[model samples]
Target chain A: MTTTSASNAGFAHGRALRPSSKVLPEHARGHNRSLVLQTLYRSGRRSRADIARETGLTRVTVSALVADLIADGLVVELGQREETRPGKPATLLDLDRSAFVIVGLDLSEHSTFSGALLDLDGTISARAEVALAGSTGEAAVEKVVALAQQLVDQATVPILGIGVGSPGVVDLGGVVLSAPNLGWNGMPLQSILNARFGVPVLVANDANAAVLAEHSFGGADSDAMLIKIGHGVGAGLLLGGTPLFGSRFAAGEIGHVVVGTDGGAVCACGKRGCLETWLSIPNLIERLEEEGDAARTAVLREAGERLGIALAPVVGALDLSEVILAGPTELLDGPLAAATVETLRNRTMAEFHGSVTLRMTTLGQDIVLRGAAVMVLSGQLGVS
Target chain B: MTTTSASNAGFAHGRALRPSSKVLPEHARGHNRSLVLQTLYRSGRRSRADIARETGLTRVTVSALVADLIADGLVVELGQREETRPGKPATLLDLDRSAFVIVGLDLSEHSTFSGALLDLDGTISARAEVALAGSTGEAAVEKVVALAQQLVDQATVPILGIGVGSPGVVDLGGVVLSAPNLGWNGMPLQSILNARFGVPVLVANDANAAVLAEHSFGGADSDAMLIKIGHGVGAGLLLGGTPLFGSRFAAGEIGHVVVGTDGGAVCACGKRGCLETWLSIPNLIERLEEEGDAARTAVLREAGERLGIALAPVVGALDLSEVILAGPTELLDGPLAAATVETLRNRTMAEFHGSVTLRMTTLGQDIVLRGAAVMVLSGQLGVS
Candidate 1:
């Protein structure tokens, strides 16, 4: 299928990319500083005058913020802009991409927890992993902390912060509400990591983190969902460049949502015909194995159709423009993805939602880790 | 059902109601003014110092903004406060609730196009309606204009603006993308009304308009959906106090989404087993009449289950806290609403989304009209 993965294209009509909000004077300085940094981060090297012009801030304000950023070592003076009909070549400034590394941990894997040292731009510089070995509760938490510490130690540059993408419903305060596999419920993971590492620690659902990675790094639309079909079927969502955290911080937790009227297999959540039962890796594998290669395409198509049934209301309700499937390419790319697109078209108002792009994500197994980096970048520096 | 319809409660966790955004100095004055107005609008009467304290704005800034508002006749000094503390009693200020009236038009009804003159508080001061009289195309457009003119004439106060809740896919630019029922395809409704009335005109889909009214006046959670099941079914969404207009301004166009795997009735949109076929007023009434009272509960329950099947993914995906049904309470309340709640609980992860409130709107038939007023208030004055 020809996928229309235009970056931030869905937000082009009504809302702007990061629309400015009304601010009090108390917040203006910090907001403007982030705006200047964001301008530089997104637009590459730009002079103080250019930053002021783009952000609608006065030159004086931009200069002061730039000076502070430079002093903080978060920004660096890049020689000068190439002269093009200017009175004088203005000195350029940009993010100091090499000055700091972020430690990111992905706790969504079934057998092992992975960690990475990622640069400011989400590039993985170093990697580490520790097998779960049937670890649960405090033991699993310890392994995560050890992995983060190892990644932190491997970083040649100063560590900016640590971001963890754990499985389950993670609240705004980074409390793991529930992660059955990890034997966690209401665990204060963010505070624990912050106390241990003494840096800004951000923890979110792995799917939530992955969506951010897709939003910030991958060429996904601003109004998009990144469905992560791994051990369990979950999704991450970004609406107008902001992550949506629902009432219970259970936003994007679509794994257990029953898909079709005709119920089938039972889910681990004790629900019959949950999307996870049809789409989760183990469930799909077992079903395919049971049916053999003769039913391979049929099995994949059926699973894909079920996913579409689960997603149709989401697409129709939210008017989401892009859906990026993050999982095994061999399973999600061809027949399954095609069937999903067909199902969506058949279900939604054709004229309005007919063109919703459904595609497999370019980021593979490291999506959650890289998304963890994005979480840190957004939390600490206010830039992603 | 015991409903948890706390006003704006869902937004209390992560995002604040109207969170401050980064702004340049040029935009700060207007933003602060809106903040002050919004504070008084939500909190009744308050002194300038109180507004400043509540908004984190400087006392001097608040004083200036309040003065400007008073000069504009949008706000009024409501005398001195009844002393509850030591020192001189501060002067209280508030929005002039009757200073200006808004003209609201609801073009969703099949037989009549209705209009109302509403006060700043969304109270309908006067109402008018023009029968369709078999009008379509240009004739229908003319009737809408006539009804608006009648309402505008009835307004004893200066008109703030004209807001229309039309039935169709209305874009951000106020153009009706397609309202097939009214033979409107890409009609420039807002512009036409603006050119005639010489006031700010805002047009939106009827359901979209209704949701805004619920969000602003009906004590709805900030993250909620208002399902309008009239001649056809549609939905209006508010996420964090902002209306969601999808990629094609059809974010809440859920009427046509095929609900179940087992197809049944064919819809006007040429879809099988669409949510509208099960949930629309015409469809429900027809089914109930055909099967008589014996099958009334069963038919309603089945329709409600289908509605839940359509909504479970949406609830799980967005983590929405409330779903308000806006239509005939006789048809939607009791069994249908209860079945929807039950289906939602059964389909979704019960622990996380068990409390998603499904309730009928108290606004009754005036919902779209009052919602139009909200559109006017939000568009012209930045407060809803």
Candidate 2:
């Protein structure tokens, strides 16, 4: 079912890989500088002229900013490159990897933590995971702190800040409003982590973090929706390269959107006819166990169709170019995926008829961890 | 629910007025200057520092821009103001009413009309409208051309640009992909109007125009969803003070979102369970007429609840602070509006709780036309 060839390539071609420079506000010069640093980090070492050309900033501005960055020890000049066609060779610049490291943590229902040692350019130098079975909030906190300490101890770089992506609604102040998966509510996550680690800690919704990660690194450019059809059918929206938190930070709760709206299976969120009731892996497994493979296949197909219909309005309203599926390959790569693509094609406005694509995550299970890392980087850098 | 107070004083309180400076892209300094000029035109005379403070630009930048504007004969110094302090009174600036005019056209299913006059800040100095019934595309074009000529002939000011807002999927190039209501498909509206009007012409979706108007002039001050609950449930999204046009031009088709999957009223778009099928005025009227007034009231209430639920995901996703309802107030003001508010409050996450407010359109019938004018200004001045 890997039908992504020229169509995906063309879609990629049509999209601008870098955020448009025209949209950057002048007052956000610092933000633009961070963006340039991020781009360099993502693309490895590049010359000052190359960075300026890529960022759409004047060479003079880039030079000044680079000089400041070097003076601040955030970035370093990597000597001069070999002359290609000119007399003088240009000096290369790179993020000072040893200057600072960001710690990323992901907390879920079953898993207590996953930590990554991210460098100045958001590169993960090391990673570790820990289990948290039957752990209370305090215990979980302690465990996470210990795990972070271990990760930091392993890292040869200086720690800058920490970012935590947990399954729940997180406020701007890093308070977890509710994490039903973890049976948490009103948890002062940032305060606890900050007190323990003696550093700034940022907490964000896992789905939002994942969306940011996908937008920043996963290559789903343009306004894209990342549907995580795993234990639940949560969605992450990247609207114009930004995660939409909505009025309540509940914007990506596509799982609760009633697909059937009548007598449908009840969802864990105490809702009926939720998309997740039919889309989740356990639900699919239960249905398959009860009704055999054929029925299960049929149900999955229908699930895909319903999901497509459910998302039709969002697509129509947002004119998104891509919908990235991140979950079990067995589900997303089969008839369910095909049905989703078919429904999207048929239901969307004719103008976007063949333009939108449904693609699977290339990062697979690592997406959550990477997304959590991205959350930390973005938070520390003030990108989001 | 007439709840006006000193807090609701127009333009004085930040919340009661659109933040004029928030949407201006940093690069569009000239556009920002023009916006200030337009604001002064609409609001009559305003002091220089007031304009700067209102526009969120640095006072120095505003002064420089205003100075240039005055030199260009686009603005005039309108006498000095009495200082609250014992210092010299500051000189006030106002839009030169005789400088330039803009033409705003509204093309709906029932009407093809033109509005012309000076938009001194956005205030209409003189206005005219023309009706086009039983007119073919060519005939409509000719009529519009004649109407524009008539307006120009009667005008005492130079014209800047012409803006037309129609119910269709319009591309940036002004090509109308389809207007099922107006029987327009793939029409090169911009080129046609440009050829006839001899001025820059902008063609955009009516909903997009409405959002632009709300963002520029209406009381919208934050991330908002302007739902045009007229004949259809079209929506315009304002994210971070910018109109969010999705990948294709199909964003804001909230009408097509399925509210029910099993069985519901059939929509004009050849779909079932569409939000429009239940919430639109015509749909409500039909249901009310068929089901009696009591049943209609109940239905309207239920419809509002459904709309709230339908928008819950969006509200949760974008964390929008306001939902602006634009259409007939008679239908939306009572139980329907209450239901919408209730659903949004109950369905959204707790943090978003008490954060969103649903309000009626302030512009009434002139909304679409004003929106069209805004669309033109935004396009002509390159302000997204």
Candidate 3:
């Protein structure tokens, strides 16, 4: 039931989902390798026969794939299984969870760039950060690289790869298509980091990365959207466990979508009543402070309602039942979450989408960092 | 290329796109079969070697699959390839487009249940309609069954299958979850039709069916949303050529989503300012009548803007570049389409989403019927 299991991996599903497409001999081989790794990753441990039976692969095929994985240092053989009535105790196989560490960077924070060294299971072992201090463009990029270097240096084991969660529309090739606050446009962040660290690098929108962390670790549904409300608002969409990379690689860029007809505040994108005006952290906090304690509930409710207005169509259009909110828990949990649920039920078909759930993310502030690790796991080792 | 080709088929992609899933020997056989068929379908005619080279299948494998297809009467050899070459001319192969006919029913029309007998290429060879002056419940159900029977009888060739495009939330099992206008609730339309006709039957939401037609025959982009505005407003989504069936099989049910913050007309769904209030044909015509000719342009523009407001988030969320409008091209093409484009550009990230195209569907009123045929093609023959 793990989200990152081969049954739910996002990297190859969306584009490669076409059944009419040919599955070459090489594709079958790669698919089988991933299948074996994911089976062990999901079950924690299994014998060759158990994996063969579960995946419908032959015993010989499983044994061969297992040997290859062990040679690559990706899997290790534990002691024989403890059984009372078996003819012979079979050897158990599992992922070498501690063999290598992954470097993850979160560059979407308002004033700092943060990085972490994480194990295969996404457990953070080390952390580092560098102050951004009003930096933009090249300066901000330098801060992110320095933080990643600091975390990479702290890794005690061989580094698997590096992953980054940045604020912008990132292309599939890991180019920062645009990030207004960080002053990047068409920056090849992944290539830059890969050259510097000489390891695989993967970069994605912060929200997109956060959704992966939620899927891999926080138990989010296969069909869900994670809305990350920070200095700016954006969403990450996972449909049937596949992240949607839109035609322009801007699939989850919903911050500038105008929400209400009765315009209120102008947005940075030059649109009035954009969802960011109502839901971004700074705007929500500013409105709450202006209204005082008596109207705190009202302000939060209004903001939540606006978010619901923006999300109701998405829910109906995607048939999504779960929406995870990654942001300040103190501001988004109670009144805001409740009002979003209420508004969604009122706007969408009750029998179909009435059960749509809105809740704060359990991953907290480390979600993007962990998700970055997942990207590296998926890209470098075919495991997430 | 042909949208229904194996390279773009949607049937198993979204659910079976997991690379970690095992591609059993049986799957490879089926995949290669589909590849050969889609290659010929896309090229109109191709030699076995041409298909082998294009699909990367061994020539022997393609020859074996071609033999099976010919035996099944799904393909026909059309003489040898015509060219001035030194070697022997290869035999040309193509789909047996007219060997079997599909019975397709469009039950979403306001006053009529339309049906058609279509070729494998989606060309209608015969048509029939049953007027529904004011039928609902059992009477409407009978009307649909009768219409399908009529079209099946009209087929000149052996019936390949039957497909129905009904107005409602249709489950994957083809049950009409709810279509209040026709008084259908939990009616197993597909099974009932199959029982009556002794042929495979597939049913989907009318808009969902129409979107398939747009993708298969109308040259729609892989990532597109077709908005069908008729008796009630709804949408059909295609991401990377795969139709999105949400968790509850209610994806693309956008009519009920509330749009403007300032409430206006109350909808049949008991919600004010739902997208239906602003976009549904009857509502728009009524509003236009109330405003008279002097304000027709203004009324349509406002409705278009409201529609844009409803769609901006969808475009941003899915990164859709093309939106095809069905139903009353006169109303949706000129002023409405222009305003929708303008609003979309204003509400979304300008640089990324500015090129999003809003256009009228070219398939006109027959879209759902054609889409129904496509459903049968994909379900019964692994083609579309």
Candidate 4:
């Protein structure tokens, strides 16, 4: 049961849950390799026979793939298992976590640049961060590079790839199309980092990164949505194992959607009554301080309702059952999330539908960086 | 050049278009059948070598598969193709439109149950309809059955399957979980239709069917979305070729998302300022009649803005570049669509990203029935 749950969790983390043969029939060798790697990474050490049985791969295929992975320094053979059910004790295999480390950058934070060295399991090996001091453009880019370099220097094994989660509309090429907060416009962050470190680098939107982290490392379900409500608001979507990269790679930009049409406060994007004006942490805090306590309570509740109004259609359209809010838990988890759940239930087919779960993100602030790790793992090593 | 254009169209229609070697790996035989059939269906008649070349399937494999298809009556051999090349003229093949006809039902439109016999290439052979004169429940269901039977009997070729596009929340099992318009709740439409007709049956939401039609037969882009603005307001989402069938089968239920905060019209669902109140055609028509000619245009514009306001986040969240409106082209294509496009540009990343296209559906009122055909083609025949 433990192994089964772990596999399920790992399935959401990376790759499809169904057997490769049943789900997709075109991929041959690459599919086999990913299945083997993901199995070892998620379910812990297992003998070749166990991996084969779990994945529905032939034992011969698993053994050969495992041997190749070991030779490629991705997997390693361990000592015999101590389980008492077998006639002969079999040697176990596991992902070689120490064989490579990934550099993960969280650039979506409000006032700081943070980077971490993450192992195969998405655990932080070391961390380096710096508060921004009036930097923009190349100056800010230099600061981010310095942070990544610090983490890169701390790597205790072969460097896999670097993954950065930044606040912007990132293209498939990892170009920062826009991030007003970070003062980046068309910055080729992936290429910059790749050239600076002479290694593969992947850059994604911070919310996309957080959702990826939630999906690949934090056991988020398929069709789950993670909304990061901090200084800004955005969302990351996972429909099954695939991240919904919209036509323009702008999926999950929920902040600027005009809501609460009574024309409340305006947003940075020059829109009135946007979810940004209602849901951002700054706006929430301002309402809390400027208005009375009743207003404070009311603002959070109203903001949650507005969010629910925006999401009700999405949930109705996508049949998404799980929604996770990533921000200050104190701010989002109380009346805000409760009101969101209430509004969503009232607006959608709640009676006829399955229960929709709304909860705070378990990973807290480390979500973006770990998501960066997930991107690197999946992009470079074929496993998350 | 014709062959090339056809390949491009078919490429947009089916198979994993990304180098075929990655993403989806396990749909081997299914993939090949679709590739070959789509090429023949869209590109018109072509020699076996041309299909093999376009699909990247080996000539021997294409020959063998085409031979099986011809035997199965899905393909037919035409006379030899004339060519100026030095080699002997090759035999051309085409999809046998008369070999097997699909029965497609459109239950989305108001006051009628319409069905059609569709060819393999999605061309309508014949149509049948029964007006619902204030009938509902069993009476309405009986009329729908009669319409389906008329079309089923009109299908001169071997019947492929029956596909119904109903206005409701359809489950994976083809049960109509809810359809207030038709007075259906938890109706086992698929099973009932299958038992009655003795053929495979598929029941999908009308919007879902329309989007599937747009994706499979209408030359839609990968991240295309089709919004059906009939008596009801809903959306059909296609991320690449995958339909977004949300967790509760409520994906595309956009009508009830509360839009206006200034207490306007109350929805039947007991929500104020719902997209339903603002966007439904009846509501729009009422506003036009209540206000004057200026108000007629203004209401449509405002409705479009409201629709855009709801979809800005979806476009932002899903990065959908192309959105099609399925309704009266005269109404949706003019000021309404323009206003929606304008509002979306005003709210989303307009300057920093690629342009978003908003246009009326090319399929007109027949989109849903054709979409039903797409469901059957993909489900029973595996060749959408």
The order by descending lDDT is 3, 1, 4, 2
Q: Give the runs in model 1 whose Cα sits over 4 Å from its true position.
A: A1-22, A80-88, B1-22, B82-89
lDDT per residue (tens digit) for residues B88-195 in model 4? 999999988778888999988788888889887788989899998878777777887888889887766778878888897888778888999778898888777777
The best candidate in terms of lDDT: 3
DockQ of each: 0.47, 0.29, 0.69, 0.38
Tell me the RMSD of model 2 versus the true structure.
8.3
- The C-alpha local distance difference test score for the whole of candidate 1 amounts to 0.84
Output the lDDT of residue B228, model 2: 86
Q: Model 4 segments beyond 4 Å from truth?
A: A1-26, A82-87, A292-295, A352-354, B1-27, B287-295, B330-333, B352-354
TM-score of the second chain of model 2 compared to its true counterpart: 0.80
Report chain A TM-scores, every model: 0.92, 0.84, 0.95, 0.90
iRMSD of all candidate structures: 5.7, 9.3, 2.0, 6.5
What is the C-alpha lDDT profile of model 4 across A1-384, one tens digit per residue? 010010112212233321111233334566667777878887878999999888877888888888888888888889998977958888999988888888999988778988889888899879999787868788889998899888887876878888889997888778898888778899988778877887778888888889888877677896799999999899999885567767667889878777655676767777677788888998889888888776866878988998987787677767788999999988898989999998888766555433888988889889999998888777765676
Query: Taking candidate 4, what TM-score does its chain B reach relative to the real chain B?
Result: 0.89
lDDT of 2 by residue, A1-384 (tens): 011111111111112111211222643454556656665666758998998777776788788878877876778888999987967899888877678777888774355577788765456788888888767667777777887888878876566677777776766567787776666788888777777767666677777677667776778884788888776777788765556665555667666655645557877767566677778888877877888876877988988987886776677678788888888897778889889988876665555644778988877766766676666555444332
Ranking of candidates on DockQ, top first: 3, 1, 4, 2
The sequence of per-residue lDDT tens digits that candidate 2 reaches over residues B250-341 is 77877776664555777776767778888988888888888886686798898898788677666655667888888888898888988998
Two-way DockQ contest, 2 vs 3, winner = 3
